[model samples]
Target: MSSAREPKAPTRPTSRDYRLTMYRTRHDAAVRRLAASLRGMPADIPVRLAKPGSNLFRFGGRDRRPGLPVDGLDTVLSIDVDARTAEVGGLITYERLVAATLPHELMPTVVPQLKTITLGGAVAGLGIESTSFRAGMPHEAVREMDVLTGSGDVVTVCPGDDLFECFPNSYGTLGYAVRLVIELAPTMPTVALRHVRYVTGRELFDGLAEHVDDPEVDFCDGVSFTPCESYVTLGRFTIEPGPTSDYTGQSIYYRSIRRRDTDRLTVADYLWRWDTDWFWCSAAFGVQNRHLRRFWPVPLRRSDVYRRLVALDRRIGLSRRIARARGQRREAVIQDVEIPLAESASFLDAFSRHIPIRPVWICPLRSTTATTPPLYPLTSGTYVNFGFWATVGLADGQADDHHNRLVEQLVIDHGGHKSLYSTVHYDRSQFWRDYDESAYRQVKKRYDPTGRLPDLFDKVVGDNATR
Candidate 1:
């Protein structure tokens, strides 16, 4: 483990509190606005693109750290129900996307668990879900996009285009995705959900792996509540609407709250079911105690409750303030590592022994489904993504930092790639060992030669190279 370093002081919040409702579809106006902003800014300043600031982890500075800003990019530009495609502007939230698509009996093939995540963030970060085993990442579903380049060029990027291929995991370093033509999938009226339980970790992993190639399964995810006990739930679209119930409104379906066996759920209800208490994984946030997690219905919708919880820490200003005041991070860590199928059993065992992060989420992702390989490092073969999200202990320098590095090393050693959505402690060399730095640099140079956007290396590993 590396030596413990003091937590840096908290600067101004990078993301300003803004509302997407202020503006409507204006792609042409947005293009001209972005072009003018880029033209006016100095060449050396990197440009920053942001959403409404509800990400569970920080990818880059919320505000433009070394750059100029071009705000109000979040808009749904257009929705083509007949073509089953949506032309989404930069920074549009998944919630808005879902609302628009549901009315047309269609939805994006893959949506991240959280509705707070932006379409662009999912494209740039790790956006995988139970359905990912078939549809791949959210970015893969994008047919094309209109990008406002750092060099002040408004170019259309198709699936195979250089800019389009490298856009995922670029963290807006390449340019701002002004308009995205995303492919949508036809959705059933309801989802036939089945919960399968296993007594052992090996059994759970193997069972989940077997269904990766199953054509019938529309969505699949596993949860590890303890070292041994786990449950894998598989859902398929159903033409027949099962017993209708409003599960999304008032229930706490976090992993802890979910049953080992369950019934059917509406398509929309099942999609955002984990919104309450993050599938009971918020136990790490002192919400694990059953008593604290159960709150009376305040008339607020299920989506509102979960959205508030996701932003609670930031709104209260407790964790970051404490870290800044004490030079230590006391908040929980969220990470997802994509592990090859063959090594999962042993890797899960190693995780149980070395890390105690609990209520772990296991999701399968397909390598073949994704047309454009994400800029982030992902193993080539089909893999299982282990979502190790929890607050093991306080980041009092040595212990937490050591634990984090150990987890990263475990992922690398076991043929896995760590998702860069959370705090990335990797040095430049370590990052490149897992990522393709040369390819990233080449793409950045082509689209953003003036350094208008920050490079992937700077965003993930920082400017200073570490041993």
Candidate 2:
């Protein structure tokens, strides 16, 4: 050109760039508000989170203390498609996170079975899924996290940090995760399933061990209807277009395992298959009944909805009254325990003989790294997670915690550990022995020296804690 043209104006940000910037700004403001709230809290009272819902089965009187306001903390801030990473707010549920990531053809390394489970809650507590045998637990996928410590400081902790190492299974005693950078894995458009039936527990566990290290299998878990009737379901990702089954409607997922030897589902449906019927626990509320299933709204068919109904029953003692009227004494025996693969059969045999609950869920897991997280210790090897949720009739002479206590001792005897998400019956010494007390104290001291949060033992064990 004959004349020098004026420099072009700076390029404007793209729509995605603008949205990401806005999300980050809102996240930062929310963090500041939470930190200020924590700092303003009186030293005498223990702290709690003002979350809308909880997946925890520990039911009791609600804490009267005002909780920290955590508004705007349940958002997905950014996603790096090329890097296969996502930075999400702590309170973001896996359901929402999946929605955000699926369009990019990616998903978290290990998506827990339930959709309502929060990213932060899964990290702070523990979460496992079918992919756990290869990818490990949810916390193992976190690249870094911003935790709001009890001292009112927001610290970005990575893998090597002591706080980060002990954060899982701490159950928020040290601090609460506000933002997390997590690794993601590519996903196919659909998943194909194969249900292999086994006649015995030994056969079931042996069949499971074979698939744990197989590169071809993308997902692995088993269901034991009884000692003699069990099925090891294996899932594989596929790109081939095919007609998929619909379990969200009247057809139940667990029942399908028993009926169908082969099935196919879209990636999203496969990840949340168990959530539709709450893994057969919906039977307690008559949702499994064909008559009632017709009337149950599809949108409300969620794990959280069933959990709320359970909470309401607990509040009014509806189940207790029903049992009393029937001249029966039943104890809720909801629990998940992990046993070394070699001893899984023995543990399951003992469980079948003692605990009457059936349709036990068995998921295999292995640590992604050689070094296990300190709080929830798992040596570098394969372990089987057994989950059973139902009420067992208590003998006239037995205590309410009889079955739970037996499960705890059985887990210890089998060289295993039990998850603390449900009712805990351990004394202080026993609980400390099962979990590394020394390691916990050191990390707790470092992150929360003033002890703004409740102690792990007191928080989890509740009234059962032996002072």
- For model 2, how does the per-residue alpha-carbon lDDT over 1-467 read when each residue is reduced to its tens digit? 01112322322434467777777778878988999999998899877888888888888775577789888888998889999999899999999999999999999999998889999999998999999999999999998888988878888788877888888998989899999999999999999999999998888888898989789999999899878999989999999999999999989999999999999999999999999999999998899999999999999899999999999998899989989999999999999998999999999999999999998999999989756777789872899999999999988899888999999999989989988888898888989888889988988887789889889999899553311
RMSD (CA, Å), each prediction = 8.8, 7.0
Candidate 1: regions farther than 4 A off: 1-25, 59-72, 255-260, 284-331, 369-374, 377-379, 394-400, 462-467
TM-score per candidate: 0.83, 0.96
Superposed Cα deviation of residue 366, candidate 1 (Å): 0.2
lDDT of each: 0.69, 0.89
Cα lDDT of model 1 overall? 0.69
What is the overall TM-score of model 1 with all chains considered together?
0.83
Best by TM-score: 2
- Ten contiguous residues minimizing lDDT sum, candidate 2: 1-10
